[model samples]
Target: MSQGDERGYGGNEPAGHTDDAYSTLGGTRQTRTRLPRGGDEGDGYGRRPARNSRSLIMVVGVVVLLIAAIAFANQGGGGDTSGNGAEKATDAAGAGPTAATGTKPVQGRNGTIASGFAHDEQGAQSAAANYAVALGSAEMFDKTQRDGILDAVIAPASVEKFRTTLDKAYSIGFFRNVGLNDDGTAPAGFTFVSRTTPIGTKTTRASADQTTVEVWCSGLIGLAGEGSTKPVTDGWFTITMELQWVDGDWKALTHSQKDGPAPVGGDNRASSADEIAGAVNGFGGFTYAR
Candidate 1:
């Protein structure tokens, strides 16, 4: 079959069902899970993608995560190589193939997410992963922080454009409408959390200085608070990013997302508000690869 055929999402399928939509379109065996025969579950790849296969991707990504770690893990913990007290950080995994040899490593880490970047596919993937985190973060619900993120990661040309639109998306009325304070603050005794965890990333297209990356991200978006009507909820979205090897790192040129490409969620018991809050504070996010 043509790769496109393998990835096509035509029937009742939603948008961005990479495996179904993409496989039908490109005939690549990209999808890891089987879709429901027809109806919205197999809507193809136009609007909302399928959500019943994400766990499969997570399983696959765990392998990549291990490989990436081995490629960079040091032998004896880590020794100081920077002449200063700090140990020189290792290069990002999966970067040598695209980067000029010996290019310095890129920095990464944001408030619970990863940021900064090196100059190759690994770096690009890292950037894409983190950008997905930032884009899906609760910060996006705040105007000032959202603008700062746009300015920091967005391609220079597209920043102004997306910003104008996002301004309306995160407006005061929008926040109030969502049960947030007019200033985008959470009410007392409540912890607002919005996070996207990347399952995997691939380079659909690439150039020495540019790359088109696709990230399969499973995200949780909802309000967390006692007495809240809308509790924490989850969704799956795929983010496609166009990145340029800029000044010293990869910067997003354009990014768009579509929903679905999801799988049916397992029947795990929902945790209480306090339990969720404790988990959020105890665990941290990771710098993704694959």
Candidate 2:
């Protein structure tokens, strides 16, 4: 039951009936279809050791069940590695206990996510796979890229209380029920489509400071164009993070989610809306590590 949070927001944008609010703490599971039973990401361990009184941990971060892919020009999301790319990222579906162990990434950044890692346990599983792609991206629905990604992956003594409970869970009724606006963007000629990739990672507790790491994601939210009505979709979940190593790398004190190891959705014929907004604007996302 604890493969733990990964990719699904989707685990992001909430509105009317969004579930998968990161597993427990008033969780209902649905893993994302709309979102919002409550989010900020779940599981911080033992519930609370006064982690800023845990107000929705990262709030709306369980990415607000897709924050509708918090459009940084709709880029692709990806991270995680073990060996043989984790058996082709679980497709061959056999020899994967966390694939792809070429281990390259991690030069260092922070402003745009990925930062210096390697302090062990594969650098806290590459800082929990790029902090679960900036906690299920689409920049957590704005507010200045969600306060610069909670000051680059939270945990500076719980960054201003997770920016005041994710600025009230990205309010304005979560940007008009996940359609976005009121500064969350995506209105004219819409294109927004959130993304989170990962697919492998596992630690369940490491050293050097702290670690939990459990990625296994696969997210992509809605809104392409053509009279948009929340079109885009792709989900699978698991995201339990609890990293530490602060002031140098690996942040996030918590972040939980769940739903699937997911695999079984074929028919392969659903790309439209301007070819899914031209493959999410000619794809270009990758900073996450392993």
Candidate 3:
């Protein structure tokens, strides 16, 4: 049987003894037990067994066994074991390095964003991951905030180009599509949500003064409000950033994004708009590091 197939005491049959089990009673001898039928008691066969205390006990026993079996199976027992499967899944879910060498997650911050990362491979990876968050944040919607982020994270030589490209990307139509105003503000009763959470980071190439890092991330965007057509949703993507260690810090020379190293979604219930809005407002974002 396939692993996904449901298994019971019987193979694709009802959970009871088969008719053939009564075909013979002794070696080379066959016997049949018959019960007389009341004219109206039978349903086109011998009269059905009358209900009794012993029969009731047997019925209860079968029901209890079935219930226990089903519970065990659902918990990944029997041929459908998921204990190992779950462990494998957990291992697969982790994206980047697992061991820690006592390195600090961040060296310092530039205003609200992280800055002054260590000038090593781990530092470059950390810088890239944190930069991805800053670039993908709701702050990127406004011109001034976006410029500030670009100045802090992008290499000085690449700042102007990055700003111009991002300005075009966050156009009026894009804002409207995400339920934000042309000016990138949320509607009167709505809260705009644009957040990027980096899952892990890898230093693809590294040198004394330059490095390339890949950051696997999941993001949430849209509006949270009553009757909002565009509800906040999550998506996974990866960002590649080439960094230059300049002026005692790593800065982005160029960056690009592509889709997924996404993990399977969980069964958590979707929160309501009010709850989502409240949560977003109550909690603040972090300056992440590897």
Candidate 4:
């Protein structure tokens, strides 16, 4: 009533009048408004001050500073790289992140399996990887090669134990179930494939005398031929081995396996049996695997 009825706008001012403006965000704001310019016809409502242009500049400057800070942080200020001028890592305790050591591979072999591994964390991981391959290979179905593999890869203290256990495990029934003959040979016109490919190796526990490691692997098993009941299929798994420094090399004292970090299957078409068999026969596997 004081401003609208008869005093403020009705008596002393025009029909339309402007009021003082106030605005705030988190208790910070401008409480001023602009007067009409010299001869401009403006609505009753006033505009913010022309100097408010500084707010836009301030916001843009802040954005630019934020972007620069992010770039610096990403350029190895994040402490994830080992480039020049970066601090070197100390992993003498055998509990460090995995990286390429560029150590020469073991030049010795016990049968087809690698041997003469160094008595260090790297050696432990290498032994675990190769042992997983040997233990999962198609040769393990044949008792003779199986026994030799156990002898080469198992710790001296556990060699006989593993041999006896595997003898019972790989029975004639096991061979037949895997589409192999009684002598572990592929049936006529078919190729039996049981291959394990180690993807990465990790030393879970390590010491001078013994170490435990896990190897992540991708494997293929079954038969490769036309009209085969057991077509080759792929799987992923992890193999854990407890290795001992036996005599002069790393050997498995105990071994166990568990299923995957498997990836989702791709939409690629399955190849024909002839193609699969051809690939298996044409490609020779690595003998001195790491």
Which candidate, 1 or 4, would have the higher lDDT against the true structure? 4
- Write one digit per residue (lDDT tens) for candidate 4, span 196-277: 8988887765555767788888887767776665666666777777777768888877765555776755656678879999
Q: Give each model's clash number.
A: 43, 43, 0, 0
Point out the worst 10-residue segment of candidate 3 by lDDT: 1-10
* Tens digits of lDDT, candidate 1, 1-290: 12221111123221111333223212223222233333354334333322234422332222122112221221122112232233222333642343233544356554444556766667777788878777767777677788788767766656665676455445454454344566777766666767788877767766667777878888764446555533455667677777776566666766655555788556466788678767766887765543
lDDT of 3: 0.60
The number of clashing residue pairs in model 3 is: 0
Name the lDDT value of residue 171 in candidate 3.
Answer: 56
- The predictions' CA RMSDs to the true structure, in order, are 14.8, 18.9, 24.3, 29.7
Task: Identify the runs in model 4 with alpha carbons over 4 angstroms from their true place.
Answer: 1-99, 287-290
| Cα lDDT of model 2 by residue, 71-141, tens digit | 11112211222312122222233323665578765776867787888766787787788778776778777
3 against 4, candidate with superior lDDT: 3
Better of 2 and 3 by lDDT: 3
lDDT of 3 at 93: 40
TM-score of 3: 0.65
Among all candidates shown, the one with the greatest lDDT: 3
